[model samples]
Target chain A: MRLLINKIFLALSILSAGVGLAFLAWILITLFMKGLSSFHFSLFLNDLIEGGLRNLIVGQMILAGLASLIGIPLGMTAGIYIQEYGQGRYAALIRDLSDIMMSAPSIVIGAFVYAIVVVPMGGTSGFAGAIALAIMMIPVVINTTDSMLSLVPRELREAGIALGASKYKVIIDIVIKAAKVGIMTGILLAFARIIGETAPLLFTSETSNYFSLNLGESFPSLTVSIYDLANEPEESSRDLAWAASFILTVLVLIINLTGRFITRNKK
Target chain B: MEKIFQKLSLSSATLVFVLLIGIFITLYSAAKPAIDEFGLHFIINPDWNKEIVVETPSLRADTVANDAEDDAIADEDDMILDEDDDEMLLDDEDDTVTKTIYGGLVPIVGTLLTTIIALTFALPIAMGIAVFLAEIAPKNISYVVGIAIELLAAIPSIIFGMWGLYYFAPIVADLVGGYQVSLLTAGLVLGVMILPFMAAITRDSMNTTPAVLKESAYALGATKFEVIKDIIFPYSKVGIIGSIILALGRALGETMAVAFLIGSIFVLPKAINDPTISIPVAMANNFGEASGLGESALFYLALILFIISFAVISLAKFYFLKKAK
Candidate 1:
């Protein structure tokens, strides 16, 4: 009876696992089919008014890059602090607070930004949007960086300290260097997380009809455009949304795969 | 200078603490106007209207007043019904809908329903995949599957929303033989979106289980299933629960994708296929046009979401920090 039950359990586990994979496959297949069916070479070059997605693609890159520039440094510092100096009463509190901020809804962060930056500025801007996305980015970076730094063995830190190196030098030279690949992976993952963020951009960037690199003005972003285009009644608009989705999905896929490569410890 | 550098790091970490307090301050300050006008009833009421008069929550207990209001409401409802029977159509123009409005019951109910439905669908699949990759599969295969599963997490919530709106919702609608974009569709998309986080947490917890425990179980003539059930789950209860809370936070605050697939119906539903709009989605879709109380009310929704997710995230952080220690 135990053998029979075990066999049944194994079958059930495998079957459920297949369902997970199948669902993932189905989503990708449908996305590819719809996106590619409407996709043409011109889809990459034509403007939104003329029915294309190139501008939004460019906009997403600019937004992600800016957000990363702001978030990566702040996040890494917090990460380093938590691992190195965040040991007592205050640091523990900071650690908890960071986790709360990390889990707070992206939309709430957007609304918060809307009040502080957008409302005060009297209009939405790409810079405000970048800050919102950066807020979302920081917690992820801190978490990943904290864990990655921890993975740098204790002996390495001890060795550096024994050599009369300052704690700062020990971290910069030994710890960070040791955890380079993991830190890189964390940064990449943080970038990937914010790139597809729509809620933060909604109220802050406020969606421009045209491509604008000016941080003072409203900007086009892939997720926001996808939101706008998906809701449209036109076939061309829906097709544009599909292509954008495909691109975003593929981009994230590549980054995540690269992250996997970097974090893969052969030893 | 090095001391300054160290101080900078400490202050930077402290900045996140300041940020958490800042979120509540900003939201509450923005929402204070609407909250003052509606009192606590702002949350307890379901109607959200522009031109409608609102009944105070105190009057809810007065049967005589309620009967008078109900009679007046019925007469007004009959008048509106004579003009149009469709609830959604009646909702389009603000002046035409009934009075006693500016309630959040619908969005609150919708948010909970969609999140619960999402958790229901995601938990099983997440656990199964986690079990496979963590315990059952060969090392190489597990590594590949693990990476692929993490890739699923990397896909932005917006893409899921777009796909759900353009592709997934239609198929589900077809399967149910109902209209596209409803509560069920939104929930399913959320389910798929949250699977990675929950599975990743469970897998981590599973990874920490001592090999010796499983081996001893096996030596005692226990089956693989018996070992997992008896040893793995019992040991990882906190982590498993922590992941569930994390997934709940993600689902509760999920905006773009849920907004797209959920049909933006403000009315609470009695059926799975009924249209609904969650709190985050409410803010997403309407904040652009919102003014005065309408705008502050959206902030109120954000405030509620913030508080709830704050508690959930705290529990999750507790578990996660324990693991780190």
Candidate 2:
């Protein structure tokens, strides 16, 4: 009876694992089928107004790029403080709070930005979307920076200080350099995360159909437009949404795998 | 330059601390108007955007007498009053008071119900997958399958929403006999979305169980199931629970995954398969057009969602997971 029970349990475990993998395979197959039917080379060449995705693709990159610019420095410094400079409960407190912030609702973050930035500006803009993405990115970047910096050997810092380098200089010149690959991978993953985000950009950037370079104006967002298009009653709009979704999934998965590959190579 | 760098770093660290409190305060103040108007009653009141007509003292007696004289006629008058309440409020001096009541009961209930459903559907499959990865699978198989599962987590959630609406919901509806877009379908899709996340973390927690303990159990002639039940599970229980709660927090705030599947209505569902709205779905659908109290009410929902998720994540990270660490 015990052996029989064990066999049953093992079978259940394998079945569940198969179930998990089957869904992934199913979703990928469906995406490929629907997305490829609508996919065309023109998608990269023309703006959405001209029936392609160039503007949205460009706008999303800009928003995520701007967020990385703001988030990387601030998050790295904060992470440095937590790992190197912080002494006791205060550092631990910040670490805990950052983790909590990392999990805070993205839509609530959207609402918060809408309340502060969008309300003050009197309209949605690319800047608001970037800020929301930055807020999301900061905690993730901090998490990566904190963990990567922790992995740096203590002797490296000690050696730098012994060479008469000041504390900040030692950290900048040695500690960060030592952990560069891991931090880069973390940033890549964080970028991958925010680029695929739809909820935070739903209201903040509030996707535009036309190409616009002005950060102060409504910006095109691939994810938000996908949501809008998917919900429309027209079949053509949904086909476009599926095509966009396919493109997005491809980008996110490639970036994610690249980050993982870098880490694996380093290890 | 050194002093400037230290100060800059310190302030940036301080900025993270400030940002959390700032979100709380900002949400509070944005939601203040609705808070003052509805108070805690907003949570329990089921009537969302309902108009209540308050008759003047002189007319109250007449309506009461009419109510006693003819119940059907009074019901008709009430319907007409509701239809004309807006125009009457605008034109009247002080004869009648029209109050539009916005309550959160339906969406709040819907949110809790969907989350419960998600947790129920996900827990077993996640546990089974975690166990398979941690114990049953060979190292090569485990590594490849593990990466596949993590890739599932990397898919954008909006794709999940769209796929659930088209391909998944129909099969579900056919199986369960309900509307294509419904609470059951939304919750199940949410389960599918969170399954890989929950499995990945749980597998990590299970892997933390020392190999020596498992080897000892096996040497004692214990079956694999016995070893897992007696050794690894007992060792990693807290970490596993923490991972589950963390996944719970993620499920709670998910907007797009639930938005397309939840049917986006304010009615309280009487059955598991009924169409309903969740808080995030409500805010996502209505925030664009809502104004004045309507907008404030959405902010109120946002504030509630933020607070609930905040507390849940903190409990997971600081309490259960802290112990595991």
Candidate 3:
């Protein structure tokens, strides 16, 4: 009876994990099956279809790219300050707030951008969207930076100090070099997250139907366009939504896999 | 030089505070027009017309005409004055809009309801998996299972939303009843979305239960089930709860999946099976249609969502911090 119970418990766990994997498999399969059906070179080259995602892909890359550039530096600096500089009440407050912001809903960030950037600047623009995405990216990068820096043995920092290196030099030369891969992973993950975000971009980046590279103009992203198409009245729009979603899924999977590979390789 | 570096660090730390303040200032200014018109009532009520009167002269004229009609129908002069007073009351209704600061109660309620339902379905299965992974499963199978569960966390929300829309919603609608889009479908999909988070966290937490404790239970001739119930669970309760809270936070903030499945009706629903819009869904639903006051209303909705999620996240952080300490 005891052996039977243990077997039953083990079987249930396998089944539970299997169920989770099945869901993941289903998502990938569905995307590939539908997305591949509409996949074409023209889909990528075209500007945008009324309720399509051509412009959205370009816009997402630009916005997400710009956000990472801004976020990575600030986050690294803040992380260095927290991990290397002595912890004080102020540092504690900043760290706590960073965590809070990290967990804040992406849409709230959108609303925040809407209030601060979009409204004052007078419309939805890619610049505003990038700033909003950057805000979302900051906490993640900061956390990663701090964690990575802390993993550098204290002896290494002390050795640098003994060599008469400046604090900034020590951070730049020894600490950062040590944690480069981890920091890169963090940045990549942040990029993945920002790209996947549809809610925040929905308001700050006004949905556009066509492709335009002008930063001041409104633009749609792949996620937002997928959302728009999915909700539209047309069957073709729905198919386009599936195609966009499939492409997005592929992009996210590649990023995740790449991040995992880099981390594993570093280890 | 040391003082300068310290000062620079202080300023940098202060800069983070400045960014947070910047966020607040922006939210305040964007919300100001609606707040100015609606006042504190914006927190209590759901009036989206706070600035429509200002934006459209025709709307103001219509309001005045409606008030005049109410005034003419009254019998007493005092009552007519009272009817004018009632327009004042109607103006006070505008105060409700002011007070309604995006009365996120409905959306907050919807988010909590959906999260709770998802948790109810996810926890047992997750715990079962965690237990098997940590204690019961063969090493080879456990490795495969673990990798598979972790991969689930990699799937983006958009894919989840798409799949939920086309595939899961239909199956759920079929199994439960008709093809109605409901909270149940949302919760079900969200459960799937969060299963990996719950399972992974639970497995890690349960793994921390010292082998000695389980061994002691087993040494007493306790069955595997008995050891799990009495030894493993009690030890990992706080961590398990922490994991659940973290998963709950994710559920609260999930946008696309819930938006696709929940059939985004704005009003509060009567049952789990009924269509209801969550706060995140409210933001998504309004993002496309919002213009003018409708836009501000959406931002306000977004603000409300941020606050709700902020509260949940803070709580989870606090719990995890306490557990870590």
Candidate 4:
């Protein structure tokens, strides 16, 4: 009787897990059915009003890339500081502030940028959007860097110091190399997050029906365009929205998979 | 050279302070025009349109100027509107804006209502799955089930939104015999969305209960149910509560999926079947049409959302810190 009950319970676990997976599968299938109908090379080459997501695609890549570039180094440095040299009251305050920033609403980050960068700069420029995305990126990188640095064997650091290495040299060579894969994972995950963000770009980076390469100009990202198009009354716009959503999702998933791959490869 | 490098590092650390200052300065300046126009009452009062008409004189001056000096007077008058007007406007607009801002309350309430309902439904099922995996599930099946549950966390929110829109809404409406885009349907869909987070967290928490606790309970001739109730549940209480709070945080901030599923309406709902707007949904709904004061109003709404998420996340952080200590 006990054995039979155990078997039933095991089946229940599998059943529950199956239910969750099935829901995810259903969601993906629906996106493909709606979005794939519009899939074409032209969708990647033309501007939105010109019947493609070309500008949006480029804008998203550039802005998110810039955000990652700026955010990763600062966050890693802060993380290293907290994990290595930090102690007492100041470190505690920095840690708490980073936590608060991490879970602050995405839209608030947008508002903060709108107030700070976009408003002061005189318009909703891509640079303002990048700043907002960078804000989102910072907390993720900080957490990952801290964790990765913490995981480095203490003996490794001591050994570096014993070999006549300065504290700076020890961090750059021994500690950073040891935590490289984990730090990379954090960066990829941060990229995945900023890529799908729609709110911040709405206020700080949105462009209307025009294509330009200027960083100071407002440029619509794929996520913002998808959001705008989805709300339109036109069927064509809605279809395009689905396609944009699909593209964004696929891009993020690819980043997530790459992060997973990097972590797994290191292991 | 070493001193130069240290100075460089210190300056870079100073950049974090610079970034924070930059953020504050930008918010203050961007909000300046509206802030100057509204004064302190801007946040409290909701009458966003304080219309000050600027009459540019047509070069053909025969058109009557109410006063020849009224143009400059109007500019000065715009500045000189009495604190009394501000006070009265505050009373009237405060209620209205509060309604619109709180107009989100229906959605907020609906979201909370649905989340509770989802948790009510999901908790027992999640607990059952956790118990099964920890104590009863065969080792091979357990690994597969665990991997599958973890994968659910990886699924993007937009996909969930699309699925809810195309598939779940209609079926839920048919089965539940109510409005197609009611709270119940949103709740059910969100239940599915949150189940993975709850299940995985709960399972880990349950598994972490020292083996000796459960073993001792079982040796005392406790049945499986008794063991779960007396030993496992008590042991994992803090973690279980923390997991639930984390899940609630996710549900609160969830934008795309809930936006698609919950029919976005600005008014408060008197019934569960009524379409409602959540804070995130309200932000999305207004983003397309927002201009001028309408745009600032949306920013205000976003600020409120930031407050809600900030509060919840801080709570979670506090719990984690306590546990860590």
Candidate 5:
């Protein structure tokens, strides 16, 4: 009876793993097939009426760039504070609260930004959307940076302090330098993540039809455009969504795979 | 200057705490009016008229501006104004209804039910994969499989929605009683989306289960399966459970995939194929034009979802801490 149960368990494990991999392949293949066929060269051009993707791509860049600008610095600094200087009940509180924030439903972050920024301003804007994504990015960066900084050898910090260097100097010069690659990987993953987010921008950015540099107005993003277009009744609009999804999926996969490679190489 | 740097670092950490408090403040203050008006009935009462899904744009932007012409269609789903109770204020001059009575029971129920279904599909399969990667597979195969799992996770929720809605839903529609977009479809896609999360943490904990413990079991004449069941699984059980709870949190808050695949309607599903919408999906679909009571009610729903996520995550954290100790 025991031998039979063991054999059955082994068969079930292999079968489930196979099912998981098969689903992965199906999702990717379907995405690539429809996405590639829907693709058009005009997508990269900046014509206003035909609904080109130039504005969408540029909008994603501006939004993600601004978000990273705010999120990376705050996240890295907070991470350093937690890993290097966090102590007692205070540090423990920060650590736990941040973990909760990380797990908080991301759509709620959209609601929070909408309540704070969009309602007061009378409408959605690129600034509000960027701030929402930055909020999502911070917890990820903090988690990664804190873990990476903790990985840096304690002897390095001790040696620097013993050599009469200030704590800040030792941290900046030795600790951050050692953990630079890991920190970059974290930022990359965070970037890849917020770039594909649709919910936060659904009401916050509110979607734009044309390319506009005004941070005061609603903006176009690849993901939001995909959301709007996918819901439309028109075939052309649906194709546009597919093309955008293809690009977004390919970009995210590349970033993630690169991060994985870097980590594996290091270990 | 160096001392100032220290101060800056400490203050930055303090900023994270302030941000958390600020989210709570803004969310609570925004939801307060609705909470005061509706009380516990907001979650339990299932009589949602137009405020449940709000499909038409007559509610868009300024409902007051469009009320005259839009009132005809708006009344199709809403009878609160038509009922004309003495409780209603009855804007005699403008003829505009001031409030849309809101209850989120359907979406809230849908969110929990779908997440439960997703976990049911995801947990055992995810555990099976973790066992294979941790103990059964060779190192090279495990490494390749592991990276593939990470890539599976990297595909965003929206893309999963796209694939599931267009490709997978049609194929399974007959199986799900002819409704293309149903709770089962959403749960299946969500199970796929969260598989990596459950498996990754489980695999890591299993990998770290102190090889000597497994070796001793083997040396005592145990089979491979017996060793895994007796030593490795028992050791990593807490971490495995923690990962499942964390994945449950992810499944609960899932928006785009559930939105696209669940037929984008707020209904108490009576069958496997009945159309439904989760809280996050309902919030996403209706948030754009929501105003007055509708806006605050939406905020209240978001707060409820946030609280659920908070409690689930904290539970997982406790499990993790205990496991670490």
Candidate 6:
């Protein structure tokens, strides 16, 4: 009876793992079938207004890129302060709060941005969307930077100090250099996470039909557009949503894999 | 130079604190109008976007007497009773006041029910997968499978939403005999979305158990199940619970996945498969055209969601996971 129970437990565990793999396979296969059916080279070349996705693709890059610009610097510096400068209660407090912020509802962050940025500006803009994404990215970046910086040996920082380097210089020159690859990978993962975000951009940037470079205006967002298109009554719109979803999944997966690959290669 | 750089980094760290407080204040003030209008009753009141015609004695003496103390509260109570029969309150001598009231009970209940359903569905599969990865599988197989699971987590949630709607929901509806988009389908899809995430974290926690403990259990004539149940599970229980709560927090705020499947409507779900709206779905769908008190009500919902998630995550992180760390 005991042996039977053990065998049954093992079988059940394997079956659960199989269930997880099956869902992934099912979703990917469906994505390929539906997405590829609608996919065309022209879909990339033309704007959404022209029955294509050029505008949204470019626009999403700009939003995520701008978010990285804002988030990486602020988050890294905050992380540096947490891991290096501070020693006791305050550092721990910041670390704890940053972790909490990492899990705060993304839509609340969007609402917060909408109230502060969009409301004050009197309209939704690319800037509001980027700011929302940046808020989401900051905590993730801080997490990676804090953990990555912690992994750097004390001996390395001591060596720089022994060589007469100032505290900030040692941190900037040596400590940062040592943790560069890890931080970069973390940032890449952070970018991938935010690039696929839909909720935060729903009302902030509020996706435009036409491509506009102006940050002051409503910007095109691929994820938000997918939500909108999928909900539309038209079958063509639903097909377009699938195609957009496929591109988005491919992009996010590639970035995610590249981040993991970089760390693996380094190890 | 050192001082300047230190100040710069210190201020940046301070920004995180500032942002958290800012989000609270911003949501509170934005939600202020609805909070003031509905008081605490908004949470319990199920009526959303409900307009009622209230009649009061038009005599100046009667109106003046009613306005003496607690005017808004008294008037709202009258409005609630007259909601079903607006015409009954219509009289030539009586002044009719039209008021639109919004309440959060439907979406809040909907959110909690769906989350409960999701947790119920995901908890077992996640535990099983974690056990497989941590103990049963060979290291190489575990490594590849772990990566595959993480990749599932990396897929954008909107894809989950769309796929759930188009492909998954129909099969679910066929089995359960309900609307394609429903609380059940949404919760199940959400379960699928969070499964890999929960499994990966649970696996990490399980892997934290020392080899010696498991080896000792095995040496003592323990089977694989015995070793896991006695050694690994007891050792990693807190971490596993923490992971589950963390997944709970994630599911609570999940928008895109639930939005596609939840059939965005403000009715109370009478059955497991009934179509209803969650707080996030309500905000996602209505934020565009909503104005005045309607918009404020959405912010009110946002504020509640933020606070609930904030408390839930803090409990998981500061209480449960802290010991694990």
Highest TM-score: give the candidate number.
6
Query: What lDDT tens digits, residue by residue, belong to model 1 across residues B1-325?
Result: 6798799898889879878889999999999977766667667666676344222344445644467456445434443543444444445444333343366888898899899999999999999888888878999999887777778777788877877776788889888866687889999999988887778777887887889988999999999889888988887777777778888888999997698888886777778988878899999999899878889888988999899889878877786537633
lDDT, candidate 3, residue A190?
78
Each prediction's total of clashing residue pairs, residues at least 3 apart in sequence or on different chains, is 3, 0, 14, 3, 0, 0
**Model 3 TM-score on a 0 to 1 scale:** 0.85
5 or 6: which has the higher DockQ? 6
The stretch of ten residues in a row with the least summed lDDT in candidate 4 chain B is B95-104
- Candidate 3: residue B58 Cα off by (Å): 21
Can you write out model 3's per-residue Cα lDDT over A1-267, one digit (the tens) per residue?
Answer: 877887686677668656666776787788888889977767777766643466888889998998888777777777778787847776777888888788776777787777778878888898888888888888888888888888989999999999998887787889899999998988887788788888788778866777778889787678877887787888888888888877887787688778878999977
In model 1, pairs of residues that clash are B45-B103, B47-B102, B47-B103
Task: List lDDT for all candidates, in order.
Answer: 0.82, 0.91, 0.74, 0.70, 0.83, 0.92
Off by over 4 Å in 3: A1-8, A50-54, B1-13, B32-105, B139-141, B211-223, B287-300
Model 1 TM-score relative to the real fold: 0.90
Report the lDDT tens digits of candidate 2 across residue range A121-225.
999999999999999999999899999999999999999999999999999999999999999999999999999999998889999999889999999999999
| TM-score head-to-head 1 vs 6, winner | 6
Could you report the DockQ of all the candidates, in the order they appear?
0.71, 0.83, 0.51, 0.32, 0.71, 0.88
Inter-residue clash pairs, candidate 2:
none
Per-residue accuracy of model 4 over A1-267 as CA lDDT, tens digit each: 765675565566557655655765777687888889977779988898798998888889989999988898878878877777667776566666676677666766777877667767888888888988998888778788888999999999999999998887888899999999999988888888888777677778885566767888888688777766776788888888888877877787788878888998987
> Candidate 4's error at B201, in angstroms?
3.5
Q: Which residue pairs collide, candidate 6?
A: none
lDDT for each residue of candidate 1 in A1-267, tens digit (9 for 90 to 100): 988898887777777778888877777798889878877878678667677777788888898899999899899999999999778888777777877788889999999999999999999999999999999999999988888898888999999999999999999989999888888988998888889889999989977767678989898888888888888898878888888788888888788778877777534
Compute the lDDT of residue B130 as modeled in candidate 3. 85
lDDT computed for candidate 5: 0.83
Clashing pairs in 4: A115-B26, A115-B27, A116-B26
The candidate maximizing DockQ is 6
- Candidate 5 lDDT over residue span B1-325, tens digit each: 7878877777877878988898888989999988876677689756554422223234456655675555345445444444644333333323333445678898898898889888898888898899999988899999999888877787878988988888888888866565888888888888888988888878887887898998898899887789888898788878877888888998999898888888877678998777888889988988887778788988899989988898899998875735654
